[model samples]
Target: MHEQDFEVDYLIMGAGACGMAFADSLVTNSKSTLAIVDRQHRPGGHWNSAYPFVRLHQPSAFYGVNSRALGSTLATRQG
Candidate 1:
């Protein structure tokens, strides 16, 4: 891999749901700069592979970072 110097207060890998949320909290709560790198063409991890109208098996509040709310627009997994 090529070597490069990254200057930032925080460096996060993977723009997966958790990573994105953590980065958001850091940026929102502090004056620090951040850099995010992900191999996926898009963010959201496996959610990208899932169809819409799908809700998390568990409560949305239980999924994301504690610093933020994932919203209460909960969906049922049962048909």
Candidate 2:
């Protein structure tokens, strides 16, 4: 494997739901170099494979990283 220079404050290997979640939170909280990589061509991980209108079993608020809030609008609307 090619060893790429990864001298960032944060380097996320997967741009999946968890990867993006952490990166987003890190960017929002502090000034850090963030990199996200995924074998897939998009974010949201496997959810993208699922049908539309199919929501996560767990609330988005609980899924994403702590610093940033995902689906805040959805949560507010649901409440």
Candidate 3:
């Protein structure tokens, strides 16, 4: 696709956690617009395609957008 088709102050290539985190920081720090595109059908890169039986080895609180925690709390384990 042409660059003009999708114009933004920044063009983030991936929509993974890192990419989203960076975008969030940029958005929070400035007014610049951004566009993120990923090959996957949805966001959350690896997490999205992970096996259904698999769970995050680390707590979800540390694995999402910087502005918000993913799960209730890392210290707490729920069945």
User: What TM-score would every model get versus the actual structure?
Assistant: 0.58, 0.57, 0.66
The ten-residue window of minimal lDDT in model 3 covers: 70-79
Candidate 3 structure quality by residue, lDDT tens digits, 1-79: 6555656999998888788999998888888999999998877778767754676677676775655557774343554
Which lDDT tens digits does candidate 2 get at residues 2-77?
8877577776888776788678778888889877878878777778777446656776767646664567674433
Mind sharing the TM-score for model 3?
0.66
CA lDDT of each prediction against the hidden true structure: 0.74, 0.72, 0.77
What is the C-alpha lDDT profile of model 1 across 37-68, one tens digit per residue? 88878777777677445545666666656455
Top-TM-score candidate index: 3
Task: Give the poorly placed runs of model 3, Cα more than 4 Å off.
Answer: 1-4, 54-57, 69-79
Which scores higher on TM-score, 2 or 3?
A: 3
Each prediction's total of clashing residue pairs, residues at least 3 apart in sequence or on different chains, is 0, 0, 0
Between prediction 2 and prediction 3, the one with superior lDDT is 3
